[model samples]
Target: GMAEEEARMMRIDPEKLTQIILMGYTTKEARRGLRSAQGNIDQAVEFIIENRRLREECHREEEAREEEERIQRRYGLTENGQKINITYLQQLQSMGYPRRACVEALKQSNNRLEEASEMLLTNLDTLITASRVAKRDNEDDDDQETELMEDATHIPQLIALGAEFEEARALLEIYGNRLERAVEELLQKAQDSYETMHEHNDPSLFERARTAVEKRMAKKIRLAEQSAADQQRRT
Candidate 1:
């Protein structure tokens, strides 16, 4: 009785059975096929071939849809290639390309993105060279100005004040315009008779002054060292 009931249930639904048969198999053929296989799916594969075909067709359509969407999102067709907007221009400016140079490079390269990037890099090189040249010119101008100022000033004051050649040159270069500060500093040095400003005209006097300064510095160094030693011992 169970086998008979199973056999009756195994009878295919007429609507589904019609669709399958319309695709090519007859109803008797579909039922015979299912019954011969005893409802085993692996054995009834050819009977469900239409379903498998429909599934594969739907999968292909979905893949095509996804590919088109991806293309639109990645490279939306705009009027003038991919939009090189203001943000990109600002980014180029921050990388050190002058505003005029950036615009010129973009125009020269026919607004091609990669070519424009290369042009900006080339302009940066030119700017660096120009900066170096300007720095050198400025330094030369400063040296010339210092020499002119030194020639115009009294050399005897520098020699008498025991100012080193370099210090005198610097003062002449910068302080020639600030006469009050220069005079005040000179007067202070003269009053203090600081060892740095004391000239040693004779070899003996030079040696004597050198020895005195050295001894004074040595005395200070010894006092500092003794204080450090006392602190260390206490610790």
Candidate 2:
């Protein structure tokens, strides 16, 4: 509506009256300023306020961006710097230090990688020393218990009564050899039993009776050996 009125005024005999209203000045003020300035409403308005404001805003934004760039440069917190720091942290983690510990070590070392690694190694050494001390203390406790038990029991009496050292050593050696042989025989027997069990789901009654007879014969042989040994020891 204002623009239409201005256009109507411009279409009238004088175009100056249209410029005064659009330039936000009264007709008398427009006339006074018209001698020094042209009656150009657009240029006047731009010069008076709009252009300055736009230029100031643009300058402020540019300064703000420059200040941000300056801060990032000063602190070395740019993209490349972040990448380098991340790589450093990863290297610390790969070297067996926990991430949080690595970060703290880095800070304590003034962000020096070598110093941080040395600190971490020192911490590990401390932990290892503590663990060894604990293990030694545990071993000492066990030794004390064993000594106490030995002092409380009658070990000498047990050794004297039917406990021949040479015979016991010889028997243990023989038993060890026998155990190896027995294991091999048991493995073979187990394999054979598995095969036999799988091969024949049902067998004749005579076959079952024959297996029972063989088991009884082996048991009688063991009993005879044991009886002969007992009789020899008594004599």
Candidate 3:
């Protein structure tokens, strides 16, 4: 083992090692780099830099892998030890589903794209709404990812008017980014969503007439309030 020990000792230049240390390389690293470069100081310095770069690159890649694993766990992908296929995710995104809904649907449908598509198409409204709630309770990355996936400018504008992020983003898309029109659409969706459930098709004709009239009046009042609010905002 004398040869092995001698090889380990090699010909590390103390001055080069010290210089490398002064440049913030650890003494152990400096010694390794200097020996590897055969005591050429410039080569040693380059070796140290390259070594550190490689290490940093490796560390970054490891962190990315861990983050991906964490996402899979958070969205239930880890439950079955299955990774969401990137191709399917991209396909779903191309189909206009936000990444959050696509991810959840993929998990629920066992990674079957067809079932996920159907689930998303049928329950999109509920999923989009749930996605908002989930995002609000999630981390900064969720906010950043949602911002990237949705219309960045209009969601916040509509949020200031009390719309949820998903709802606001979806409406803005439908109205071709017309902010006021989007707001009106949002107000319309919310205004009678609750009252419509109670509308009776077989009520006494008189009772149906009176309730319908009341709903019309109530809708007009809300619309007026929205218009005044919009006008005030503009001024």
Cα miss at 39, model 1 (Å)? 69
Off by over 4 Å in 2: 1-84, 124-235
Q: Candidate 2, residues 1-235: lDDT per residue as tens digits?
A: 9998666544422475566557576555454344324555544444445445886999999997775454333323322233124455568755544444444455455567887678766664443343335445544332221111111112222223333333323333444534344344445655666667876553455578899999999999999999999999999
- In model 1, the clashing pairs are none
Which run of 10 residues does model 2 get worst, by summed lDDT? Answer: 144-153
Best by lDDT: 3
Candidate 1 residue lDDT tens string, 55-166: 6899998996675454334322233454323444455544434333444344445456567667655454453344345446545332222223212233324534666545
Error of 1 at 101 (Å): 0.2
- lDDT of candidate model 1 versus the reference: 0.53
Pairs that collide in candidate 3 are none
Q: What is the lDDT of residue 117 in candidate 3?
A: 82
lDDT of each: 0.53, 0.49, 0.73
lDDT of 1 at 212: 100
User: Roughly what TM-score does model 3 have, to 2 decimal places?
Assistant: 0.47
User: Who wins the TM-score comparison?
Assistant: 3
- Candidate 3, 33-87: lDDT as tens digits: 8887777778877888998899999999999788767666565562256887656
Indicate the worst ten consecutive residues by lDDT in candidate 3: 141-150
